[model samples]
Target: MKRVFWRAGLALVIALAFSSIIYGTSTLKNMQEQKKAIQQQIKKEYEELKAKKDEISLVYQEILKYDQQYFEVQQVLDVLETRLTEKKTEIETTQAQLVTAKEKEDVYYKNTKERIKVMYEYGNTEYIAVLLESSNAMDFYNRLEYLNKVVEYDKTMLRRLEDIREEIEETEGRLIIEKAEMEHTQAEALIRKNDIENIRVLKSQQIAAANKKKEFIESEIKERQREEALLDKKIEEHIAAIERERQKQNNNALKFKEGFLKWPLPGHYRITSPFEKREDPFTHKIAMHNGTDIGAPNGTPIYAAADGEVIYAAWMNGYGNTIMIDHGKNSSGQHVITLYAHCSSLVATKGAQVVGGQTVVAKVGSTGRSTGNHLHFGLKIGGAWVDPMKNTKK
Candidate 1:
């Protein structure tokens, strides 16, 4: 009876142990599922944030185009302003000429009236009288010439004064028309300048709004990251266990063989900024630059740095549209990692295998902490930031 009781007790304990084990497993699975759901939510939110950023970039590009047009309009306005000044001076000169001609016309008419009265009083037959007094043919010819000269002189003076008056009137009329045209041009230029100024103000407001939106989105992203970090730690721990078991079975460590890799970018690639101490664009403080900034036009293709596994491919804080590759081991037995940042779009997925100088991983962009379109390439030795130029070829 005693032996049978002891065996029954042992069986009960075993049953409880098995049930406890099953319960623990079920609880852990539920926890992992909850974490996974949160992670998925983070991913959804990140996507929305990036979409807003892209919109902002497009808005900035539009502003740039408008600025170019504004500059051209301003140049035309300058010319119009100058021409208007010239027209004003011309009008002044024309008015002065008109006044002088009017004065001369008055004098000419008054003098002519008096001279005509005198000629009438002195008898208008002077030419006939002089011809009748000639003694011979030669004398008659000389007296006739003198009379013709006096008559022609009076007629020529009147004709010259009349011509001068008509010319001044025509010049004044032309000047008035030109002045009106210049005033119209000046008005049009002012209108256009005002329009451009209004556009600039509007664009400035939009740009500020965009920056605010970015800041808000970035804050939210950071909060989400903080929450996700806890989950990530647990997930990494689980993955590390699996990796350790696999490495034990192989009797070897996970390592990559190192070699001189091909240059990731193609076709006359230039480093806009080098990996050195420089002033931070945002803070204006001196800081160390960890990577070389390769300048490129927006949408320029980006290739993988070497043959490696894509360890991370996503948008990260301060490193937008980032890709991180694990390229085996270096001479110091440290894991060689290369990072690419500020891409417009990504083609490679996480955990994807890629070949050096071949895979088109992303396109260059001005995504995060950047002033223009470019790629930020980084190197990490033993998980610490290192200069990529040491390993770069030309």
Candidate 2:
């Protein structure tokens, strides 16, 4: 009996240990699955954020295209309006001339009618009587000559009347054609006006929709800040290395033109945001803006700040399409570098030489963390980022 009880207890212990081991294995498997799911969720969120950014960029680009089209239409409308005004003036002048012509025609017609009536009343009897009463052959011949002159004058009056009638008909035909052309021009102008209005409405609607998605942008603020800092550090390191190498090579320093750096954007002087500490657009936190933001229409040409070699021309972490030009050392021996960011397209390639105020380096755009179309320009001198406005000239 004792042996039987001991065996039963051992069997119970074995069964309990097996159950515990199975439970532990199941819990471990569940934990691993949960971690994998969390990673996937994070990845999915990041992808969604990228997609939203791309969508905003495309929207801005579309709006820019519409803006250009609107400008072109406005020009056409102005020309049409001018033509219409000129045409109205021409028509008015023609109408006055027609009135004058008709008056002259009426007067001549009345005079010719009177002459015909008198001639008809006298008929050939007066002419024959005058010829018979002539004192000699010379006088009779003179009376016959006078009769012929009178008949010729009557024929001239008839011909003049026919010419006036033809003039009236021609004037009337020209008036009709002018009126038709004016109407056609009016129709064309109306179509252009309508097109401009439609584009304006679409652009306004798109802007409104974009504004409503501010929350989405706000979510990316923190991540973008971190990425920007990292990118800046990377740039600083690279520039420093370049300067060191340049210094090592005697007379190898890059050359730049004299005077202040050329303004990157022409016809775009409005500063959307200055290089000062201000509330961040995305985070609403006080942050230092390392660069100046110049508001401009998208696709506006961006020129090089100074003559320099293109060092970096590619997409950056938060700056989107970016360009960096090394303008060598200044008169003070401080290494000068210029940065242009958030470009829609890049014109200068890396390692290419560019001229200040002459080379078109890129096109203005709303890329990366931008809220609208503009340029974020940065100037680094002696390893420190400074306000670009201080060294730029329009």
Candidate 3:
């Protein structure tokens, strides 16, 4: 009876244990499903957010394009204005010359007319009397020669004055035509400026709309900051690795002339951001900008800052498409490196040699953590990041 009672109790315990195991398994499965659903929802929200940000990004690109165009047009307008000033001066000078020529012609004409009038008043009798009063054949011959010389001189003077007037008139005509052409060109440039202004106004409206969603943009900027941090680490590691290789190779020979670095993006010298500590664009916190941000149109060619070997040309986390060149060493025996980031596309491949101010290393872009199209240029020396503008000055 005791053995049977013990077996019954053992069976009851087994049943309870089995029931608990099944319930635990079921609960675990349900929890996993819930977690997966949450993950899916989060992913979906992220995608939606990305889509909205991309739409705004496109608008920003358009604004950038128009801004670039406006700059170019303004440059053209400046040149035209300068040329017009010069043209006006030239026209004034030509007019002065014309007036002088006219004055000379009028003086000669008045003198000749006075001479003719005096001779007419006196009549042919005077000439007849002088010739008749000659003493001999030699005297008459001398008198005739003198008369012929006087007539020739008068004719020559009149003809020369006519030629002078004609030449001056031709010059005036040519200048007038050139001035008109310049005016026409100036008008066209002004028209272009007006058009650009109108477009700018439209862009301003778009920007205002974008401002309405500032919260979203601020969030995106935070995301970019995180990515930028990661990219900064990657860049430092890359530079270190390249430097190590260079040191091992003992390739410390200077590869370029000692001077200020070439401005990487030609015709785009406007520094959108500097390499100094400033309040972060969106975060409102003090942050150090590691590089100089040069505003440029998308796809603008980015040249190598100095003669160097392309040690790295690949996609980085937040820098997007990047190109790094190792410029051997500076006069101080410090290894110099230049980095160009946020490229639309890279032209120079890894390990390729490049010439400063000549090689098209990459194209400008708004890739990675960028808010607009620009060239983010960084300078590294002796394994430390320094202000590029300061280094260039050195």
Candidate 4:
């Protein structure tokens, strides 16, 4: 029809510059393998969080050495129950002094059996009838000095009742050897309180096996943080498909100026928030504030709001140190991308091409899901997102 539509417009401009160099070399090879899988998932959750904090601090120092030996076996069973109540009150005062020394040896055996029944009923004929009823030689020498002082006072009261029955059987054999040594120290303090309750039940079963191996290494560090959040959503879907194929090959060298785009933060910025339904300055909620922010400071810089090429720089996630670019299509066919997000670093590199207001690339930060040193920016076109204040540049 017209040289077959001019070779299908030169094969759609060489298939849009070979799909923008294969989506910018597969988005810088999946963001350098997602930064080496987030440094091997933070070195395996820091060695399983230091081996579960050193196995719960050695099972809490072996349950404090079995609770300090069960408080020294309850202080030796309270001193063997206070020496078994003073050995049962010294065996009841040695059995009340052996019943008062057998009641004073039965009152000296009833006065020595009534003086041996009056000398066996008149033994020496009552000692010659008391020397012929004494009334002569000075009353028979006073009846032989009163019968020899009544037989030496009944043999000194039977030798003091056999020495108080041998001192009450030697004080009841020393109070039965101190009540068998207080019942053998209360049976060795109840066998050392049952061997300290079996060593506190085997140290409480080794502190429940160290809290079940620290809950299985904290569920394998939450499954490696869900595989590093699916590798940050596969590096943000390959940097949004290489910024939509480098904005369809910079849709014919876009150069727009007055309101077509570009004021991506150069001098005195301000914006603070605009894109749309506000709020969410870091999940304050509401929602759709997709881009715009601004407020720069800590490091500031940033630029490239148009020309574009760098299909993405690096760490993205919530958009920390990002980049993106690709500015291209306009009139209606939409494509133009932009996005600068929380930066604070990355000085244009990914695919590098930049231009617009002289690509400074990135700086202003507060990193990902930020809240302070702003700059968010963001934009897009064919792949959706619209109000970057509808083409920026107020």
lDDT over C-alpha atoms for residue 387 of model 3: 81
lDDT of 2 by residue, 198-244 (tens): 87787668767665564555555545555555555655655555555
The lDDT values for all models are: 0.73, 0.73, 0.75, 0.70
Q: Which regions of candidate 1 deviate over 4 angstroms?
A: 1-20, 125-140, 234-394
In candidate 4, residue 305 scores what lDDT?
Answer: 75
Error of 3 at 161 (Å): 1.5
**Number of clashes recorded per candidate:** 2, 0, 0, 0
Off by over 4 Å in 4: 1-69, 72-78, 81-122, 125-163, 166-174, 177-181, 206-208, 215-219, 222-330, 334-394
Question: What TM-score goes with each of the models?
Answer: 0.52, 0.42, 0.44, 0.35
Tell me each candidate's RMSD, in Å, in order: 32.4, 36.6, 39.8, 20.1
Candidate 2 vs candidate 4: the TM-score winner is 2
User: What's the residue-level lDDT of 120 in candidate 2?
Assistant: 92
Ranking by TM-score: 1, 3, 2, 4
Comparing 3 and 4 on TM-score, the stronger one: 3
- Model 4 gets an lDDT of 0.70
Assess candidate 3 and give its lDDT.
Answer: 0.75
Q: lDDT of model 1 at residue 286? A: 78
TM-score of structure candidate 4: 0.35
